[model samples]
Target: MRNDVVRLGRLSGERSGDMMHFLSSMRADRYIAGADILVDIAHVLMLDRQKINDRATTRQLLPALLRLHDKGIPEEVFDDRFEDVHAGIESLLIESLGVEAGGRMHMGRSRNDEVVTCIRIRLREDLIAQMTALLKVREVLLTLSENHTESTMPGFTHLQHAQPTTLAHHLLAYEQAFSRDFDRLKEAYARVNQSPLGAAAFASTGYPIDREFTATLLGFDGLVTNTMDAVATRDFALETLADLTIMMANASRLCEELIFWSTSFVKFVIFDDAFCSTSSIMPQKKNPDTAEIMRAKSGSVFGAFSGALVTVKGLPMSYNRDLQELTPNIWRGMDDAGESLRLLADMLASASFDTKRMSEEAGKGFSTATELADSLVRSCGIPFRTAHNIVGRAVQKGDLSLATLEKAAGEVGGGISLAGKGLTQKDIDRMLEVRYSLELRKAPGGPAPEAVIAALGERRKQHHHDAELTRKKQAKLAKAKEHLIAEARRLVA
Candidate 1:
């Protein structure tokens, strides 16, 4: 909108305002503005170290750059007058210091490399935050599991009760899924932390530049090496989106369960008032709005990932204007997933379980019939097939009493005698009791309280290990930032 601002040097004539607006990525560029500043500072420091820019030029540029960093980029530069934050920052530098000195700050880099470098920096920070949110949700799950080790419930298949399980075991299944999500994010961080700064416009610059020097200053794990790959590839973004999509899918599954559990017909869980809302038309409705939204958000994340895949699918090697479209997708996916993780943690922590109702439901639906069949095989010395037939008939007769068992045995056990064996009515009753059924299956990964407690201990240990990894990565980035600022100050002094 302002004619005073410098236009691209390659184009000499007046530019169309509508064309600039159409070409602009200014809306998404704000997210990477701070990272852009860091990239500039690191590039300038590398330039000074290589003696590409004279001492006088370095001193003049460093102080102004530091000032920009301290006070933040001028708010006016965000207009459609510029193509992106990269150009906007360079233009401001030129406006203040004139072309000769301020312009040299771009000595060995192009916006192609500069923008991607900024993206990686910003994305790595986001990945760390996402990992922290995941760990918090996992911790909540572990704590809930520990408290509910003895609380029994029906575990379902095809929406019908298939077995009796402890709440601890059920919660830990989701914990295992989220633990894998954390691992995926950690792997993606390694790829996102690589530097792409020195690959100017898809080729190495003729200038004597040390890519490694800038990489270290910017806290990149390593260089992106190939110039074309550095600028052209966004598979790192794709990988991260894939991980987020999978993570949200896991979250959505748990959210689906929470929604079902909160229903009046199920009544397995009661959400806190903070997470529920009353219907405007029906005051009696206490809807699980938060969980429902989180569940729906998984589809949004999927769409973002799908859109990113489509954007990158057919692009040829080297940079294209289409790459500009991917950044907003990354931001949208990350924000949705991060907020969902945090809110899910808070929601689960505040919820109350209907343990009595869960226990009652655990006893219905022939949930322990397998245990009864196993008891017949173990105590009566009957073959498992014969035992299964006897129990199937008992269940089919719609009663589990001693009289029903005797009739079922006569009808289906092929004349197999129940006389003089150690099996008795008391034994059959014990096998049908949910607690007794649980105790008999104390193998590792089982739903028995002892097994669930053992699993909880191991998961807690894993949580500690994962949390430490996240902290170390974050600390390394902080240390690099402090060192960068100190080095800039030293140059100015």
Candidate 2:
């Protein structure tokens, strides 16, 4: 605490070491240091426009703040000697510009609203990066899907083969999952972009400050509206973490599949030597370390997300020190999810699926019985349950060969239904094949080669549109930052 400040005049400068350490915020505040300076610039500019301070003071403080922004605050500005960046910046300014000229910058704001404002500003950028990272992962997934449109693979349920699906169709599932996550981040950014700068410690300040002007200067979507809610609520923070958790969960699902695919028991996909690591002791051992670590990171993100929720669950209607604890989780969730997603894209780009092995596995586990049952219904006008029962009985006998199916159908009179028709054993043989099963089901979103190709075309279009949107959002931020700097320089001029 500054001994000269009127609010702390009752106390001496000799603060207890442990108490100062407990109250210190400079460590976490470093992440938002730039944001803190920007907040000061916006607020000082607003004060100058509103004439809240004498013209000379506002004029002097604006240039000083701009200078600090251009040439960053001294290291002492972020040193642990201060309680937080707010105090540290103020201390640095008072040291350089004298108290009367520099101190007026805080005339219309409090540290409570100021810190939250900085967090919102910085969090918005992080969320945009998160959205952008998801877009990159989406690109990788779509590329994998497009490349493998005709690549057959065993689609599993309960860890057993249930059907034959193309790799394209399977990869497209995660593309869609991650695409929703990208949308979630986009939505969260809207809330995070609202400005909290002028809320002034849960109430409006008496100073004739222009909240809208400050918001525009800061490139915020708009003011946060309610004074109390602006500083009190951390919902935007919580919502961002929720989006991150969902994204990580989606990535973890892919990681789990990658881990299984790289296993010796599966061998459905092979990782690049870079992505797989050899065991130290084992003569022949390859581990999917990237996938394993990526999968575990989702759990860590969840833990941080839950910790954030618990921290904010029962707080009163205002800022608290507890909110400080929530800030690190935002970085944790974003960093973990963002890096994990990038790693997933890289790991997948260099990986290749075992086309022949996947096809062979697709043939095992009676994967074609469903197709035979459907064929009987379509060609012989047999009810599906009856066909299913016949196939089930035959499957009990042995592998579903054409002879086996023919004898079983005859035993159940499906052959009788088909005997007079033009259907032949050749036709039945074609229907029972795994590739034929996939090729025949050309329904929308099916694993059929044609359907997957069409779906890939559509996903690629969506990905292109989304990627452009992400770029535009980043450009918007850059433009806002540029405008802010230009406006600051003009004010100081």
Candidate 3:
């Protein structure tokens, strides 16, 4: 049995070493160690203010905690022999100040409330990091879109060319999807920022602790209000995991497209050498390995979310050990999604697009057939269904010539006359041209160059607005931390 486990003294028996290791959360607790220390300090300051603990006790405990906060949790604090980081820190304090003052440090709070509070603090920081990373990706998308508004490409439905569009338009589609993801994460942050510190093991503490004061000191927006709900629920973590999973799902889709675009057959994009790898045996292979790995790893993130959901599903409330299994999943999910976003942003910024090949491909695969039908509707005064039938028949005949259109018109146009309809060969040729096809569809959100450019301008404004919002959020957190540490120092002095 470890000395610290014996020192804990809640259980009287000699605990098995294997049991100690099995129940230990030291590895995952490292993530929250710093937050845990800040939480301790906040709780201590609150205790001192409420006169629950003497000023001498606060004087000794706050400095020890402030020193730990300054230098960081030591390597010894992560020793599995300690069962968890909370026990390890408490053991250190008991050793330093003797049990009288050190034991009193946990007066108004339980490890139940403390752990969740630390998780929220750390999770909010990570959420901001993810939001910032997502913004960088959005920035990259906007910059790429600005450059490629006129770079034509064949847009597909069912993997068949359906229309002529620009690379900018396709990239902006992803930007719009990811923009929703950012909004969700930002919304999740609001719920995650609430405090659970004074809940005290699922019920409010008897000590006259000021929950609001502790929440402010720890930079939380407010209390969780219901003490049992505070300790009992992990819906906040589940919500965050859901947000990350959705973002990663979007990322995987973009990666799938990038993988396809980088293929030798498609040749629409060439990723930078840094993001690609050559096959060891096949000398000619420059694989889209980064994108492929990102695509695969998205599954792991999804699995983490699934595992978290199942872990929380069957457990009776009020803080089960099963909840311990969920924290590592949140950490892993956030790390995977955040790293993927950062790498994707870098990969895209370094990539080169085959604009000429895209333009040439845009003109193939009967891509402008829709425009031909629209022209027939406009110039010949035919119903759209009749126009659609004429184009479909002409496409089946494998040509867009006047003879083919005239023949198809007789079969499918239902007596709609083509004679003196002003439908000349020049009109047919113009309708079949990719650039002319693109230009004619100038409605808002169309694939036309002008429409794409206008959309890009609006997206840039939105990005700037989001970026400013992120900056303000970051500044607020920073200011809170500074104030927290300064106040702790004041109490110590």
Pairs clashing within candidate 1: none
TM-score of each: 0.97, 0.94, 0.98
lDDT of 3 by residue, 304-333 (tens): 899999999998868898888898998999
Residue-level lDDT of model 1, residues 1-493, one tens digit each, is: 2332446544667658998788888888998999988999999999999999998999989998899899988887787778888878877888889879988998888899999999999999999999999999999999999999999999999989988999999999999999999999999999999999899999879999999999999999999999999999999999999999999999999999999989999999999999999988997999999999999999999998999999999999999989999888999999899899999999999999999999989988999998888888888889999988988898999977777877888899877656456566887788899999998778988998999988888999999999999999999999999999999999788
Per-residue CA lDDT of model 2 for 1-493, tens digit only, reads 3432433546656667787678777778888999988888778777777777766786677787777788886776765657788888887777777888877778888888999999988898988788778888888888888888888888999988899998889999999898899888888888999988888888878888899998888888888899999999999999999888988888899999989988888898999989878888996988899999999999999988999999999999888889988888888887898899888889999998898888788868888889978987888787888788778877988866656766776787545545454567788778868889999878989999999888888888888888898788788888988888788777657
Evaluate all candidate structures by whole-model CA lDDT and list the values in order.
0.91, 0.84, 0.90
Candidate 2 collision pairs: none
* Off by more than 4 A, model 2: 1-7, 402-424
What's the candidate order when arranged by decreasing TM-score?
Answer: 3, 1, 2
Clashes of 1: 0
Q: Which stretches of candidate 1 lie over 4 Å from their true place?
A: 1-7, 13-16, 419-422
For every candidate structure, what is the RMSD over all alpha carbons to the true structure, in angstroms? 1.7, 2.3, 1.4
lDDT, candidate 1, equals 0.91
Cα error, residue 85 of model 1, in Å, equals: 0.5
